[model samples]
Target: MYGPVCFLAPAGVDDPQRPSGGNRYDLELMRELGELGYPVKLTPVTGAWPRPSGADGRELSRLLEALPEGSTALWDGLIACGVPDIVQAASRRLRQVVIVHLPLADETGLDPQVARELDQAERHALHAANATVATSRWTAAQLTEHHGLPGVRVHVAPPGVCLAPSAPGTPSGGRHLLSVASLTPRKGHATLFAALGALPRELPWQLKIAGAQPDAAYAAHLHSLIAEAGLTDRVSILGPLAGAELDAAYAWADLLVHSPEKEPWGMVVQEALACGLPVYASDVGGVPEALGHAYFPGETAFERPGRLLPAGDSAAWAEALNEWMCELRLRDRLRTLAEQRQRTLPTWRSTALEVAMALGGFPSTPWHTELEAAPLATS
Candidate 1:
């Protein structure tokens, strides 16, 4: 039997209308833990996370104070990392663990001072936790190196992919490139537009960007950029697709293009690969790992499921995109590799089991030993 486990996260984490990688991971983990017979309790805290108001901080303090001593509580790093005092106080009584989706400081467009402050706060918060869980090995390494969290046992529990049938790729006339990510600065929509704009106008390509407009200003900027580059007819911003719409977007696309400036385990990359869609992504945090590829110091090998380009490098992106469009053989080669890789992606159950083992404090069950001893599933 496993003891009661509390999962504390921001409100609306499981809202399908506002789909996000972090939210999906949290929701799936909680559901799978319950299915695995763990007494899982999800506590949604309402506030502007990572920078909560005074009232929000007080509410969080009250929530943590109400928990009984020796309770195992898993705190989402978004809330925990920003408020070190509350987490530190709760650590004295509760057995707290932190699930860091990505380091708070790594967020794009933050002022240097604010980033430094967040970095310091996160370092302090991780130290307060009994154990820490990172969504990727790159993130775990960042926590240890950038945050100086050498003592923390940071376990890697990457998000899992739901295996899907191979997508019937785009028909022969024009290439359809799909990019699935929220319209935020970190997602690098600007760079994507710039790269596509630099490509020849005669190239047979159409871009479908499917994601929520989290930042209205950025969305407006992207629209203006597209118009300025005379790409208004070529690009479409399909907002927040889900269920059939999202599935169809994946199926209809010839290629998946993700140009995030920083991505800790790009979940969409895995999802696209699961559907046998070739990926071309930015070589950022944990993205190469998800693509089942590696980067050597001085080699430009394109033998994997997809290719990785330097983050924010519009010229490099344009060059790669041009090659992909002009070379039918290269496209077919990537598609074949993507389909072969789809068979090896991990399921949500495996991800949940790894997370359960990371949380610890469970009674000795037969699966406990197996779970603890099991290796993390490769991409």
Candidate 2:
């Protein structure tokens, strides 16, 4: 019998204004794991994670001590990676597993010294853990290269998508564009704005941005760019929408524009696909994996639901957008491909099962054991 899992997550994971892919993954996994018959003891830790205060460290240490000896402790990387000393101390008695959505050092705009310190801390913490789980194959590879962690110990548990009702796009399909990412430099909002501004004024397209303004300065910069380009009327910055509201936004959009400078895995991409909306995303990190490929039956030739552009290349983005706007044939083909792709998306149950099998090899469940040979879930 599998014992209860001590699941440690960062606080504010449910903040409507700052909903993140990592937070969503954690929440879904918790729910689905419970449904799959695992008792999850959840503890949402409060602090500036990955750089918490001394008191925060004390709180975490106390919490770790409170767990029963030899318990299976599953920690979100944000809560565990920054405190190597505490993690190493706790490792002696607990079977600790760290789930990394993204490496702490990989966040954009960090000072070199700070990045190095975080990297060192993460390396120590992950090394101290019994096993490490990454969200994508790319992220798993990065952990190995960045921290020299053993590939055998690192497992990939990619985020799953709940299929939504297919979007009913306009007849010509280039009227609405959606971007769902926090307003940060890392998300490449500046690049996306620049590309939009370069499009001809006569092109019929409006952009709806649904995300929180996490970085005030960057948010301000994006607003100024929009105004300077005389696009204030055409662009709407809706501060984070969820549930039915987010679903409505996806349904209204004809295309999803995701241009992150660096992404571990784009949950939004899969979400868009699930809704049968094509994507125009930066070809970086695990985005390609999330986007996957749409197979054409009876033909070996495959197509992606949308285009992948060079990261940070505003000119390339502009060119692609212009093509998408002008070519009805291209739009029709991509729309059909998007529908085809939607049928193949992984479900939350599968995601939770993969994670469960990784953390504790449920040998009695023969089907789950098959995932042990192929740890990374193919998109």
Report the C-alpha lDDT of model 2 over 106-130, residue by residue, as the tens digit: 8999999999999999999998887
Point out where model 2 deviates above 4 Å: 361-379
Task: Tell me the TM-score of each prediction against the true structure.
Answer: 0.91, 0.94
By lDDT, the best candidate is: 2
Q: How well does candidate 2 score on lDDT at residue 26? A: 91
On TM-score, the candidate that comes out on top is 2
lDDT of 2: 0.87
Which clashing pairs does model 1 show? Answer: none
- What digit string (tens of lDDT, one per residue) describes model 1 on residues 341-366? 78777788987876776677332122
lDDT of each: 0.84, 0.87
Cα error, residue 245 of model 1, in Å, equals: 1.5
Alpha-carbon shift of residue 357 in model 1 (angstroms): 1.8
